[model samples]
Target: MRRSREGYEIYPVADAIGGISPTAHDNAMQRMIQAGAQPVNAISLVAELQRDWGRARADELRSILRWYFPKLQEIRAQN
Candidate 1:
């Protein structure tokens, strides 16, 4: 993940999920594929499974405020 001064600072999904290393994420994704999980990236999985701001979206809108504002107070610490 690159850290830009004016753009989004990308983070590894595995890191967000369970602090798993890159190698681990790769292995996990591979295992998931073998297990028939559509071969999605870790980031996508996090965005799908993580319920942020009381409004979890099919997309990665956890960073979007307007749609997730309702659960801000409760999830701020987690954020």
Candidate 2:
């Protein structure tokens, strides 16, 4: 995955979900294949599936919050 200033771009996934037709996501997947951007597995980046937020994801979330929510500041040391 490539990282830009905005954040980790979900590219194809966003395109896949941002579909109008029933098979729009499938078409996005096809486009990803055509562009050689096939994914091997899905990993949780934050919240939800990750449950109580893993250590790595916690740091990432802290960074994100810091960038967007300046008032929050430090998110405390990892447990």
Candidate 3:
């Protein structure tokens, strides 16, 4: 929320963050949204950051995804 106040675009990974209780988590998520933070999951965050597959850093991004998200790589391979 401080970042959002500072005019930074905050993208909180919805699935990766949580509070002690379900109610707390929901409230925190709501607060973030109210503060102008965009909630995204891991996959959506990656896709947003790597919008251009044919960019110069495509290979580097692929390497990162392969290392951190092996399941995604596997799915891509299967397709």
Candidate 4:
């Protein structure tokens, strides 16, 4: 939240972050949103960073996705 207020584009990974309690987590998320943070899931963040499939780092990105998120790869294969 402070980072957002300082003009940084904050991208908080929703699933990757946690708090002591569910209510605390929800409140923190709300505060971050109010302070200009953009919440995103892991897959969405990766997709945003790898916008172009034909980019030079495409293979590397895909490899990372495969390693860190095998289910994502499975879903892609099914599609």
Residue 45's C-alpha lDDT in candidate 4?
A: 85
lDDT of 2 by residue, 1-79 (tens): 5444566544443421546775886787777666555443323223344566556667776676457444323433322
Instruction: Show how many residue pairs clash in every candidate, following the order shown.
Output: 0, 0, 0, 0
Q: Per-prediction RMSD in angstroms?
A: 13.3, 13.1, 6.0, 5.5
Off by over 4 Å in 1: 1-19, 40-79
Model 3: how far is 62 from its true place, Å?
Answer: 7.2
Residue 55 displacement in candidate 1 (angstroms): 13
TM-score: which is higher, 2 or 4? Answer: 4
Predicted candidate 4 versus true structure: per-residue lDDT over 1-79, tens digit per residue: 3565457888899878899998999999998888878899988988887889999879998887778777766868999
The lDDT per prediction is 0.52, 0.51, 0.84, 0.84
TM-score winner: 4
What's the true lDDT of residue 12 in model 4?
Answer: 90
What is the lDDT for 5 in model 2?
55
Runs in model 4 with CA error above 4 Å?
1-3, 55-60, 63-79
Residue 57, model 1: lDDT of 58
Query: How would you encode candidate 1's per-residue C-alpha lDDT over 1-79 as one tens digit per residue?
Result: 3334565443334333431577776787665455444544444655566746365453455455445555656688787
Point out the worst 10-residue segment of candidate 2 by lDDT: 39-48
Compute the lDDT of residue 61 as modeled in candidate 1.
54
Question: After superposition on all CA atoms, how large is the RMSD of candidate 4?
Answer: 5.5
Candidate 2, residue 3: lDDT: 45
